[model samples]
Target: MASSIRDELLKVLIEHQPHFLSGEEISRRVGCSRAAIWKHIEELRHEGYEIEAKPRNGYRLVYRPDRVAPEELAPHLQTKRFGRHIRYEYSTPSTQTLAHQWAREGAPEGAVVIAEEQVQGKGRMGRTWHSPPQTGVWMSLILRPPISLAEASQLTLLASVGVQQGIKRVTGLPIQIKWPNDLLIHGKKVCGILTELRGEQDQIHYMIIGIGINVNTTSEHWPEELKKIATSLAIESGGHLHRATLIAAILKELEEVYQEYLNSGFRVIKSKWEQAAGMLGKTITARTPQGLITGVAERLNESGALLIRTDQGVIPVYSADIDWKEI
Candidate 1:
């Protein structure tokens, strides 16, 4: 198929780095004819790669695209197997949806599904996640942890910590994790994590952690309603960013944290997450299905639920809408 040909061509380009390969030579290596090789070269060029084709010299890949293709990401990703099996899609309904199907079909742990654009992306509480074309990281990672359902919420915290670390490493931005799983940069929403699980009474089948980061998108790219609250990496850093590099870093960090969580306990990650939490020890209001509770955010329980000290008493919140307030 086209992808197989592209991978072979990419291997040749990487080996030849800054050199050129004749059309005939490339065709022979790829098991394709010269005309077919040229066609694939044109396709790569259309995907934002700068390939130079001379009269008789050959074809040289002057520049690779910044898109999150496996070849582009694999070089930078340092994880053992997190992104080793990545399914990159130029456009899709949602990475989470695709990942769910893969998980159900027994995809291996650390399998990643990423998309450039999501037509039906989702946020928490059935909200629509804004995923513009080629401007953000819309990814879902499949994890099959040997844990119970009661401890599933900890994965959200772990993912938030991973994202915060990845962004900080790449951009050096002072990002903070809001309660549950929202990444904030300069007090605006920059990333969101949605954790979905499938399991039985005492065992877990698999967990799909979907993460969305608004990278390289500007304020104008957002919908009118979200312009005031939603911000992107370009807006925050005042420039464009390489999406592929960021995605690779994120997967690497996720793999590290996930390994630690599996080997150790959630205690270590919980401590780190609380330190990076935005509203810890601060007065906040949480809107729950039962009612509104005003309290000071205290600590995270073992199950990763938010523990708040209210005027009435200490309460453990499993899930709620959070808003920070000035005390």
Candidate 2:
């Protein structure tokens, strides 16, 4: 199959790095013809790999692509199923849109769809998510967990925890999670998550969780409206980061946390999220469609809804526009 052949080609390149391997030698190792080897090399090149082909030396991997293709990301990913089957796009309208369609078609759990750019990406409450090429992580995860709708919100929380841990692991930047699903570094927004679920009355079908992180984008790359409130990994870390490594780290973390969630409940993940929360126990303003409510963010309910205590009463905020500066 073409997939197996691609995997074999990637394996050869990864194992025999820097050293040039002749087409004849690769063909022998992969049990394919010299022409087949050349075809695979061309395919890899088209996928953004910078492979150098010499007259006699054959192909040498001069540079690895930063894109999150299976060939480039498989070796780095440490997971059983999550992101094991990756659909990577150079640009798309939205990873969420593609993943939703796949999930509807009975895609397996932990399937991942990633894109380098999204022209019409959406966030919570239909807000526009800014996704430029080669600047952010635009990906979606499809989950077919056997849980009730009430329990499904925990997936967003679990994803937020996973992203927080991943960023800390890869970039060593101390980032915090804003309730629901937002990753903040230095009190600015760096990442956002939008979770969509499809199911029957009581039984669940699948959930599509979309995550967008501004990785290498700078202030100038963002529109003037977002530059003041948005920050990227490069700005926070003072260096350019390998996006593939970050994606791998995130998939690993997501797999681990998701396993834990399936075994236990959201208590474990909720505790971790609350610890990393940026506004717990602090007074903040919740801008809801109804009206603005100034309250102290108390804690997360069992179903992962935010509990806000106002002067009048305790309100369970399913979703809200949060301003951390008010805290």
Candidate 3:
């Protein structure tokens, strides 16, 4: 396949990094003709890799693409299985859609679908996520955690913790979690998570953790409606961030915490989620199906449900669209 050839060629170039890898030698290693190897090098350049060639010397990789392609991500990606197998796209309707379909087709756990742009990106409560081309992180992580359907919801919290840790390590910024699946900075939205699953009542077949982060997105990129609510790392930090690098960091942190969640259970994930979660031990309102429940946010129960002490006493909120107003 073309992807395999590219991967093989990239491997050859990377192994000989900072050294001149001749076209003939690359072709020999990649099992392609010299002309074919030249074509592949040109394609890598077109994909944003800066490669230099000389008459007698070979090629040297200078820089990689800004997106999530293997040429850019593979070198930096450090997870065991989380991001080892990735499907990179220039554009897609939604990584979640493709990831779900792949999972149904028996894609293994930790298979990731990442896109530079998402035409139909989504957020929680069926809201539209603003995704711009080559400026953010749009990826779906497929996880088949050994947990029951009842416990599957806890993965959302686990993912929240992962994203928080990843963003913190990448940007060195204070990232807060809006209970459920939102990441905020300076009281504005910077990242959003949408968790979906396909499973039986007792067990989970697969879970898709879709995360969208406004990395290098600018205020001009935001629509009028989102101008006030959304923010990007570039806008917040006054410096543009490398999208591929952030994705690599996220996968690394996510895998570490995810493995802990599976072996140690939700106690560790829950504690970290609570430490970073907004509205915890504060007064907030959640619009549940029963009606709007306004209460003092107490703690997250063992099942990852938000327990609020309202006037009527305590209620465990399994699902709700929560808007945290720091009261």
The true-versus-predicted C-alpha distance at residue 88 of model 2, in Å, is 2.3
* Deviation from truth (RMSD, Å), model 1: 2.8
TM-score of each: 0.90, 0.92, 0.91
Q: Candidate 2: misplaced stretches above 4 Å?
A: 20-25, 46-48, 52-59
Q: lDDT per residue, candidate 3, 11-100, as tens digits? A: 777667878888888888889888888888888888777899999887877776666786667767888998888888999999999999
Q: Looking at candidate 2, what is the lDDT of residue 247?
A: 93
> For model 3, where is the 10-residue window of minimal lDDT?
63-72
Report the lDDT tens digits of candidate 1 across residue range 40-83: 77888887888888988898888876687787776577889898
User: Model 3: residues >4 Å from true position, as ranges?
Assistant: 11-36
Q: List the residue pairs that clash in candidate 3.
A: none
Top candidate by TM-score: 2
Which candidate model has the greater TM-score, 2 or 3?
2
Give model 2's TM-score versus the native structure: 0.92
